[model samples]
Target: MYQTKTKREKIKLFLIILIPILITQVSMYGMTLFDTIMSGRAGAADLAGVAIGSSIWVPVSMGIVGILMALSPIVAQMVGAKQDQDVPYTVQQGIWLSITIGVIVSILGFIFIDPILSFMDLEPRVQHVAKYYLISIGTGIIPMFVYNLIRCYIDALGQTRISMFIILLSLPLNIVFNYVFIFGKLGLPAFGGIGAGIASSLTYWIALGLSVWIVHVVRPFRKHHIFRSWSKPSFKSWISLLKIGVPIGFSIFFEVSIFSAVTLFMSVYSTYTIAAHQAAINFASLLYMIPLSIAMTLTIVIGFEIGAKRISDAKHYAYMGILSGMFISIFAGAILYIFDDPVARLYATNPEVIELTKHFLFYAIFFQFADGIGAPIQGVLRGYKDVNITFWMSLVSYWIIGLPSGWLLANYTNMEAYGYWLGLIIGLAAGAIALFTRMYYLQHSLQKKLDTQQS
Candidate 1:
């Protein structure tokens, strides 16, 4: 419906989409950031405990995120093609899918959490906090999934600000909840690190409630009748979604689980090592929101363009997004390099932890450089529906190449925890190169098709 005939127009529209999404992504991620910061204030043991628990939770939750992300392209294409009637059904099926997966993951999380934590051989206090942390957060899985699905639908329609508004409302509440439950205000016993999980769970439910109300009240969203139109669950529809979604889910799982694996592996080291590693990783994740938001917007913009049969425009958008990501990474790296000490102190008061965190932050600068390029290419590929290859690429790059190399370096050499971060840099660089190559191939192939048709 909007025109993007010139590069200027495209950039303008991209900013329009990118800004709200940036706010939403940052606000949503802010919960985790606050969790780490607040838990760190409680004690090094608590910080390490939440870090361990997050090592378990993030991959599972993010995999679900990737799966539900299929809805973005699905609905974006529908809107672009003016298949308005079909949008509601697809969105509805997505909700059904979310609910089913949420329930299953929650149940499995409760069953497996104790055993997983036990296997880690963490310190007793750390293990107790980790176990109960997972359990507490497990209660919110359903609402989180459902909320994310609705958010995807809204984003695909280019109504990103709605989701932004919803998350903004929830962000403050999360901090308040954390303060209350984490510190044991109002005459309650302090839960220490486990309170972060409890706060996050409550935040999820609140966000979901806000999402439902907003979607029902908002004009274009309500026009789709996502609530009023209910169709019975369709296995065929589920299959179609899984066809696009499962590979994405697994791809994200492969990438994120590498981080979790690193966290678990770091546990064998001293508590200072674990806490420092987590602080660095957490800060890196926060910085990652920039490229990540750009990549997500790329998915929506490029998907809509592809659906509207504007392959040239989609290609242009892809180039713009990937370049912007790289440029931003350079800026971010400079900031991290300059402010490493102050940033480390933000997470911990201990001099040892702070020093170790600075070392890790130095390593993270390289990690972001690779991720800046690789992450957006993944989003562009998703817009083209070229996903299966990404899954294999992630597995090979992260698990096969990255993890083993880090283990060898950490265990066999003097680099220690720093070795693992160097491995991440290598893995991410490899994945970025492979993905860029893939994106290049697809762009030319699509261009040829478009040229032939025009001729």
Candidate 2:
């Protein structure tokens, strides 16, 4: 029997694992803030354009990223099973697959940018800006996909510190690029929102290059020969990846589509309302990276533990990760609530925008708790290879319940923006409940299998 860890040992392990995750999240939020700040300064139209462009762009990109993310759990399982020699081949397959998908997505995004912008009914200026941003950013899809593949491989190897290190090193360069590109500094023409997009594209490629160098040429992973020839993509590996990844992709797509749809629906409101909504969302999303990173880490950890057949330990780690997320979110929510005004003011100057944003901030604070709880639970479920339930739950919660509720509340009720926020809260709550229930059932099933085998 495995020995139970002492409380101190548990705490130490948690801290050691959690700190890099926290740093990585903070770095991601820093990047978001940089984007927002540069876009906001470009002009309100530019800000609105980036917001809308990202609403669509992020979901599509994340959907593919979710598919690529299947590599982590699969790799983790291999690692846990002491099949380390196969890791490089798996990583290479993921790299090739992600690049192929990225090319297709890039083509679609470039071709449909104008159509999507027109459909959103953005103001004429906002539409033009958004179109430019989308086109420019679309060029970076391959780099983004490559970066995620590298990140997943590194993370699955339990070297999350590399991601953190890269982010820290790149952030300063990103800020410099943003400043030069956005402001026409050093003889560059001012491209406004397009400049921000260009900077983002360049930054992604730079980061990808650095990551590749680190993984391939650096001391540790260099020995692994990540670039070495692997058995060409097998039908078996592709099927395995698809079986695990499609559900995860759909789950994330469902949740993200609801938000994108909501944003589109809200455009029916005045521009001020949409701006307020975007600002509030920007802040909330920044905070959300914390739980998101933690959830991703837990997914890796739990998958590794389960692959080793340490069933109880896997369950314990997942629960502990959830508890840690909840505690941190509570404190984060309180801080956000207290500083709501300052946060809103940072993004917008209009009194109306500020007022609406404050209301959004209030709701956002409470929503974070549900978000924190839900993300890690889903992560654990994904780690357990139980993504089918996640897909079903997300479809039910977001499409069937969340989207309709938001539309009805926004259109029919006296509370317009608040109604949408309420819908989001309800959706998150439902998602949290469903994910937790699924996780519980998975753990119970695993325990039964273990018992039966022992008997």
Candidate 3:
């Protein structure tokens, strides 16, 4: 739909936002990456502790952050519609929402931590270490969400360089601090895996401080006066955000929790199978951050266009995003498929692990196409404030279609882990089709409205 020039400009704009966001995400993604590695280094118990802590924390933490993601479209729309005055109120409400949820999550996190760990029936030492790690990181939930709110606000305004720079700066800082605390370097007592949590909590404080200072002191944010006046929580505004956010949060939860469940079910498999599965997933997720960054940018851009009532342009840009993501994913998938050997070898030296990783990686590559396609569809849909549909789609595809079929094939049949990946392939592809089809219909209907209005 976009003319060559228009497409080029959108792509350029996409890159401008995408590159910084990519950097920001890569840096942000590294925190978890480093956490996992550091925990592995600490000891087997420490590693299990950190892994369990992550499984419990990540989904809930992501839910809180997902709720705040409504801020992106809200702020971007205000920017696009030139409703500058409304931006502050929307963002302020987001801040209130973040703090409230953060506090609730932190408290709930502490209270539920024991029961959840106990439910898993993990090793006693692993459970003991997991609780301390969680409690340590849990204390920073408020700051973490607050920082996310601030980041979303400015990012929606299309200024990502600052956040990217801050995150890039934070990565090395987190790594150094992680090293110091985990290893007891520089006079600090070694906390081992617990130390990563301590260091992570400290990082959030630093991020929050820098973020608030930038908003208060920076010229870009000063004009908007984001923090100028404190806005009390309004039931009406809160509801509006929740309307958009709750579905997105649960949608993500469904995707993550189902996969988490699959990992548990994988306990029946050999250690090699477990290692291969983890390696494949880790590799896929790292690559996924690429499309994920673009999708995040699209949520802002498409939302801005929608807010401005440039429906056709919105559609054009949306399509462009989807196309670009798919094109790039081809390369990513190819790289993974082509180099499966070296990559699998790097994950482990065991012949069995390496061989299983090779097979898993083969299956993983099949989903990259769907993931590439799905990420942007979700992003563009976000810009249009269409989220509930995705929740339903994900539920049906992953649970009803994918998980059921996989469980049957894996357990009911002899396919084992292969059945799971096969089911995942089917599910992710189904989700991609369902989401993209919905977007198409919405775009066509909007185009018809514009045509009718002109006539």
User: Per-candidate TM vs. native?
Assistant: 0.99, 0.96, 0.92
Write model 2 residue lDDT over 229-291, tens digit each, in one string. Answer: 655866677678878888998888887777777787887777778777888888888888878
lDDT tens digits by residue: candidate 3, 1-455: 11223777878787788889889988887777777567656665665566667666777777678778889998888888888888888888888988888888877776887787777756677667778989998878899999999999878988888889778878888999889988899888888878888888888888888888898889678887878778889989999999999988887777666666676566455544655676666677778888888888899889888988889778888888898899989999999989999977655566776788798889888887888999889889889999999989989987898888888888888888888888887888898899999899888898998999999
Where is model 3 more than 4 Å wrong at Cα?
Answer: 1-5, 267-276, 341-359
Q: What is the lDDT of candidate 3?
A: 0.81
Pairwise lDDT winner, candidates 1 and 2: 1
Give each model's whole-structure lDDT. 0.92, 0.81, 0.81
Q: Comparing candidate 1 with candidate 3, which one achieves the higher lDDT?
A: 1
**Candidate 1 lDDT score relative to the true structure:** 0.92
**How many collisions per candidate?**
0, 0, 0
Question: For candidate 2, what is the total of clashing residue pairs?
Answer: 0
lDDT of 1 by residue, 180-294 (tens): 8888998888888899999999999999999998888889888888889589999899889988998888889988889999999999999999999999999999989999999
TM-score of 3: 0.92
Ranking of all candidate structures by their lDDT, best first: 1, 2, 3
Best by TM-score: 1
Candidate 3 C-alpha error for residue 406, in Å: 2.4
Report lDDT (Cα) of residue 245, candidate 1.
91
